[model samples]
Target: MSERTAQLSVRDGRWTLYVALMGVPVSQWPEHHFGAGVVPTPSERSRALTGLGFVFTDGATWAWEEYPEQPDDDTSPVRLLASIRVRSRDGSWS
Candidate 1:
């Protein structure tokens, strides 16, 4: 599958990455919590997941996450993604 990345600006207000799978937010999905990357990295995807888990991507309307078993969220690898619109901090697409 092709993966896309988007950077969001929280200058207006803090944002959250909302992944809509099957027309429903992944967070709202059963046992699904977004992952954040904490150890600062060059990768936008890594940066987001490093610390800010589940935060929305820039201008992202929908996102994608791999919940271990596709639907088996309880014991899944719920990674973060930018689906709808992947933008960057400088108002550009990543």
Candidate 2:
């Protein structure tokens, strides 16, 4: 058998984008140890949704949620949240 290493993937990139877009304020969560500032384009946002394993509900909405691997019980607080709400110049959220 060959050994395999766990390398970083697109999911990790998406998660990083998600945290930045949500304005989670890294200062408050130093444990994550993320530096401030991120500016992604509309295309980048769309790519992240798919990369992060989000389900596309419509043209503009994407969502992702799931329990951690190896849960201790049936009721572990679900790791869930909706992400990305794009708005056009006309002032409408897509």
Candidate 3:
């Protein structure tokens, strides 16, 4: 099994590295969640995760948590990414 790495850009204008396992189908990627707080855009998140050795498939599953306390029209400013499943390209769960 071979590992893949990608260069990711951070807000500081620096490059970072990420790794991932190849051959894993997008449909088989595991699910992930974000803690309460602001999160980066999908592209940024993907790149960052990829830099960390995680693979993200395009059109992967995603979900948002809704706050019932807020009005239906108003969405929570604290956007969280609930369904970004990623794994190592080397085929290791760890």
Best by TM-score: 3
TM-scores of the models, in the given order?
0.22, 0.26, 0.38
Runs off by more than 4 Å, candidate 3: 1-38, 57-59, 67-81
Q: Which candidate is the best by lDDT?
A: 3
- For candidate 2, write residues 5-80 as lDDT tens digits: 1111123333244322223464432112123334344465555444443323336444444654348876654443
Give candidate 3's whole-model lDDT. Answer: 0.44
Residue 79 miss distance in model 3 (angstroms): 7.7
Each model's backbone clash number = 14, 0, 13
Reference-based lDDT, residue 51, model 2: 49
lDDT of each: 0.36, 0.35, 0.44
- Candidates 1 and 2, the one with greater TM-score: 2
Question: Residue 82 deviation, candidate 1, in Å?
Answer: 6.5
